[model samples]
Target: MSSASKDALPLRHPVRVETITLRPMTFEIAAAQPDFAAIARHIGVASLESLKASYSLSRNGDRVKLEGKITAALHQTCVVTLEAFPVALKVPVKLDFVPEAELATLAAGDTGEGEIDIEVLLNEEDPPEPIVDGVIDLGAITLEFLALALDPYPRKPGVSFDETAPEAAPESPFAALARLKGSE
Candidate 1:
């Protein structure tokens, strides 16, 4: 990679709060493709063949709702076979970006475990994420969602491991005698 290309890479896209309007803003990620590929490697993937995200940001008072979809072509090494194969994933994006002030309120008002929303906790779906510096890093958030949706142990088709028990220790020749003694 050239220095100029590195210079062009952006770590995050922090959208300003004041600029947000009712109309949705579109952001494409080709300029930072290299950075995203690096993220894939960091997360144990062989490669991120391609990545693209389209999001619509809308503010509801202090909170921002980000809804979009991420389409990625990836290369992952199968855990069972150790062979790299291509995978195409289309992951849905639904996240609520909460302001720091509101987060403080939520933290202070927490009662106990009983009050927690079990549906949100148990599901693989993400809960509201914090927005920092009055900006939301949609690109970073998209990558995070992809990481969560990825299979931890990807396997090639028709690959399987047996779970049957070992044959009962070869029936002993004394088995019949032992059974007779136990009967008494």
Candidate 2:
């Protein structure tokens, strides 16, 4: 991979896809011990015990496809109880990287903004990703998938949020007058 492409990736723990070909390629990456702290902070976890990912890459013409899974063990604070707990997660990953030139060509022909169907794009079998500088950053991809898998409002077991209904709007000051008016 070129130096510029390398620089585009996260500096702490980078899992870059350098080579692209029709033949299948695979990679196994583990976060370095020194990078754990930074990664933990990035993921908003108390601590990250470990993070590992395995990826397979293949190319069809100019489009690149990546399939992988990430496993992570971490500590997180419960949103309801404010207590820290351990969480182990496995997240599946799949991506299709389309060339920028091709995307540009498509964009050039897209003169009608309202003609685009967002629902169709969202429902596609394979989510399309833009290839930046002819490379894919698997480490960043892993993080993104990890975030998506995590529960935004994690709660400890047996913890339930019983939201007490707001107190009845302070008895209206004009209640007595209103009651009298109604009776009359």
Candidate 3:
């Protein structure tokens, strides 16, 4: 799928923007029946369930911020043994979104952006096309951030490391020399 298609997938629960304000805005959401399968798909995993995000969002001017916790259970293939392992995560997430123009200004040695991109700014190397809508999608932002934080190699408990077989013992040169001397 195209990157645009992937990023544009409908958010299970979208945060509503009541009014834009210069002051930091805060709100909480208890995700309604989160689509774990969809989330897993976003993370390139299979069959995730019982996922939820209880998060708060804040905005200051053109910069948007998200701080929250996500709890979920997932089934992932172990990188070592290839066995499926169930992993649970409750992670604290924080991120920031900044306007592209402001980011450029910062890169040009202007500290005037006020460090809004310090936490979760888009990659400087390949920044995303600027979000046209002043409104930010905090739910989508948090989910993507959580996906980045997931363990790529989840292992099942009690899995043992492989042991190498011992090598055969070699004959001692001193013992051979002593036997030859005795025979002489």
- In the range 70-165, model 1's lDDT, one tens digit per residue, is 888888888888988888989988878788878766655565653633333465656567777788767666667778888999987777766789
- Compose the digit string of candidate 3's lDDT tens values, residues 1-184: 3458646654534444335455555555334445555666777765576666665555566666666777767777776688877778787766666776776665556456655444445665433323334545655655676677677666668876667787977779998999999999
Best by TM-score: 2
lDDT (Cα atoms) of all candidates against the true structure:
0.73, 0.77, 0.62
1-184 per-residue lDDT for model 2 (tens digits): 4667555544233333356668888878898878888778777888888999998898888788888899999888999889989899999888888877776655456657635333336655754777766667777788778878888898877889999999888777699789889999
List the candidates' TM-scores in order. Answer: 0.74, 0.76, 0.62
List per-candidate RMSD values in Å. 6.3, 4.3, 7.0
Clashing pairs in 3: none
Q: Could you tell me which 10 consecutive residues in candidate 3 have the lowest summed lDDT?
A: 124-133
- Show model 1 residue runs off by greater than 4 Å: 1-11, 31-33, 110-127, 163-184
Which scores better on lDDT, 1 or 3? 1
Q: How many pairs in model 1 have backbone atoms within 3 A of each other, for residues 3 or more apart or on separate chains, i.e. clashes?
A: 0
Ranking 2 against 3 by lDDT, winner: 2
| lDDT winner between candidates 1 and 2 | 2
